[model samples]
Target chain A: MAITFPVEASHILMFARAVGDPNPVYNPASAPGGVIAPPTFGQAVAQFDPEYHLRPKPGQPWFGSGKTPSGVDKAPSAGGLHAEQHFEYLRPLRPGDVLTVEIKPGATWEKESKRAGKLTFRERIAEYRDQTGELVLIARGVGVTTERPVDQG
Target chain B: MALSASRIKPGDTHSETVVSNLTRTQIVQYAGASGDYNPIHTDEVYTTKAAGYPSVFAHGMLTMGLTGKMLTNYVGDGRLLKFGVRFTNQVWPGDTLVATATVTEVADLVVKLDVVTTNQDGKDVVRGSAEARIDP
Candidate 1:
């Protein structure tokens, strides 16, 4: 699904703070071309994805805990685990730009892991275009689902 | 200031302690800012009891963001053309992370770098590469 992502200066500031980056370019007051977003700031498009499962929506049955240990009876074996992420920037992203994002499935594969049983990896590619439809960034992300939680020891 | 091809060699490196003693609150802050509220990253009850993990962990993107902080600080703002990474290990709370970028190549107006981020235990958590525009 395509989503509209309106990049805002406050959001850039908050993201920069969250990442613990004290760069002047991310500050609206110091940046010459408005506030330039951090490199991973494009990932925040999840906020605009109306159906992003990671976010808890109102009136919906979330998988996270509620009164019970879990709101759902059975958690799926395929859990969300990020394996890889890559971004190619056509230009620096600034607060004034409104982006149109489209995400598509890339590939799926499986592997055996001693630490986490069977691992299923899925790839997703997202393209962000500015208001004028010029490509701004291309992001490729790999997500993994383990049969079991990875062993810490 | 952006790196200059005249000033760097292939083995030249830059390192920074991207984060010291990471906190769960910082993890929560990342989830709120990045809009990825996976329970495994925030909800301790869901993470421990339901997810079968020892504790809520940091998002891979958060680690990438931390590492990117070091990269941008080294390469200068708005200089990156590409950045990529693989999450080799999970980053847990209280982990102090050090990120390093090594110049691998300098050609014309671009520089390629190998990026690695390690935890307090000296284990690589994120490994990747980056390319940035540079000056001659």
Candidate 2:
């Protein structure tokens, strides 16, 4: 899936606030060519992704209460979690620039976990480019979902 | 403020950050901003009653995002070539957070750092490393 975001001063400003960042550079009045965004501003663009799978779907329960987006129906627990994240920035991002991002599923792996029994890890990649098709940034998210942790004696 | 690529060294350590206390509002807003409504990071009801956590925890991305903010403070945005983190502890509301970077490598126009986040209690909540281009 692809994402198009018309970078706004509000998003840049509010995102900084959301993370409790008090940098004045994020304010348009302070920075050149409008303010630049935080490094992880790339992730905030996911809100516009129509196919984003983390939200509560019609059949999926909220807060992973019953069944999570992983299509697994299990009792609510703190099992599925974000394991790792990476971002490769090709250039600086600023308000008023339209960023087009293309996302694709990456690789998957599994491992044994003492807390969660068996764990399955999956990755998704996002490539961000400008309207001119110039590459800007690349982001990868790795998530871990617990299958069933066996009880230890 | 672009960092001087020539002055960087493997042992050099310089990182700037905007420290802030975790808040529920930020958690919910991040959920709206990031399209991650997992509830474990925002919903106190489901998180406490069902998940069995004492309260909803902060999103790992939020801490990582703050670390990104730290990078921007030094090199400006879009200069980072690589940044990553491993979660170590659950971030609770009211926790004080600071993201830091210590230089680990400086070679071939690239600077690598050992990044970490700690709470006001001085406990590490996240550990990982990042790499960025030293030249703008």
Candidate 3:
């Protein structure tokens, strides 16, 4: 899937705050070339993905609770877990740089764990390109679905 | 300011307390900012009763984001060439996280680092490597 991500200074500020980074570089006026988005800021592209399952969309039945413990009668035993994340940056992303993100399935594998039972790992690769079609960042993420909730002990 | 190759070498390490007494509200803040609204990270009721967890936990991306801050602070803004991590453990509320980056190599005007983030118990929560541009 592909989504358009318009990087904005306000959004960068908010993200910086959320991550507790008070660096002056994230502020446009404080930085010479303009605010540079944080290295992991590319993950924010999820906000633009209309079909992202983690986000609840209007008119759709969300698995999250509303009136009951769960909105769905049969909610999965547990949600998928993020196993790994990697990023390669060709250049810094600045405010006003509109990027087109293309995500593709990379690999799939399985493993057995005593803590979580069977783990099905799925890898996703995302390419972020500027409006001019220049590749700015490449992100690879791995998600795992566990047969049961991880043993906290 | 960017790090200079001449000023750094293998074995050099930088560490910072990335987050102190992590809060659920801050987790929600990350979810809102990152647009990842997974109930396992926010809705305690759903996570405890429906999902079968002690409580809601922080998003893995949130921990990555927090760790990135320490990296950028050490390497300088906009200097990262690569960053990656594997989620080793779940981060929960009230946990204090400390991130550390150790220089593993420095050459060709670039520095490679081994990064790790640990919770109050000193248990590793995220571990990986990063490369950043450096000045001669």
Candidate 4:
């Protein structure tokens, strides 16, 4: 699925300041793309996944969908965290650019870990294309869902 | 300034980023800027008193952003094509991080770099690499 949105200088400035980089480069007077977003800005675009587990379901808590407790009581609270991130830019992302992002599932694998045994790794890829339908960037997010801890704290 | 592919060498080293002033304020700003309002990164009370963690930690994306800053400063944003990183360790407030990217290859209009980010005690915090398409 693809989601299209317009890039803005204010978002770039906010993101730059949020990351502690107050360099003048984010200002329109300094660079192309109005406010040339940082290299890693691809992650900030909201993902478009109907089955996104992180999405807050109706009446659900802000952070939880009550899915963890439903998964299995044996499943420890350790859960999983962001394992890796990768981005490929065919062109610079700039303010005022209307881009469409296609989100799709990639490869999945399993690994044996001492802390969380039989960890499962899944990759989500988001391909961003500009208004001209040219591919501008590809961002891959790898999530490693940890197996239930042998010794739950 | 943008670094051209023809100008980079196999052994060229990019400038380094050593951010020692990691504070809760930066984390809060990151949470605000990134729209990643995960309480674990911003709310110290939720993390310490509620979640039972030692303290709030910086977002992984925040660290990745700093690494990008180092690369972009060395070679302007237009030339950067690929950047990737793996979260190796948790970064807590007050821990100084030193990030370095070294040129590994310069061929076919592309420059590859090997990146390593370490904490104050030299513990690896992030390990990854990046590839940028340089202009002639």
- How many clashing residue pairs appear in each of the predictions shown? 0, 2, 0, 0
Query: Which pairs clash in model 1?
Result: none
Per DockQ, what order, best first? Answer: 3, 1, 2, 4
Candidate 2 TM-score restricted to chain A: 0.80
Per-residue CA lDDT of model 4 for B33-105, tens digit only, reads 6666556676665555444457778888888888888888777766788899998877888878878889999
DockQ numbers for every candidate? 0.84, 0.56, 0.91, 0.45
Task: Give stretches of model 4 more than 4 Å off.
Answer: A29-33, A47-60, A64-76, A116-118, A147-153, B4-7, B49-52
User: Which tens-of-lDDT digit does each residue in B1-136 have in candidate 1?
Assistant: 8988899989999999999999999999999999998888988888898889988899999999999999999988899999999999999999999999999999988999999999999999999999999988
Kindly list the per-residue Cα lDDT of model 2 for residues A10-107, writing each as its tens digit.
Answer: 78888887766777767876665558788788887767777666677686544454443323445445567888888877776787789998889999
True-vs-predicted CA distance for residue B48, candidate 3, Å:
0.4
For candidate 4 chain A, the 10 contiguous residues with the lowest summed lDDT are A64-73
Q: In lDDT terms, which candidate is top?
A: 3
Stronger candidate by DockQ (2 vs 4): 2
| Predicted candidate 4 versus true structure: per-residue lDDT over A1-153, tens digit per residue | 777757788888888877667667787666544567888777777533344443344664554213332222332244456789999888888887889988899999999977567878899999999989999999998977665522223
- What C-alpha lDDT, on a 0 to 100 scale, does residue A95 get in candidate 3? 90
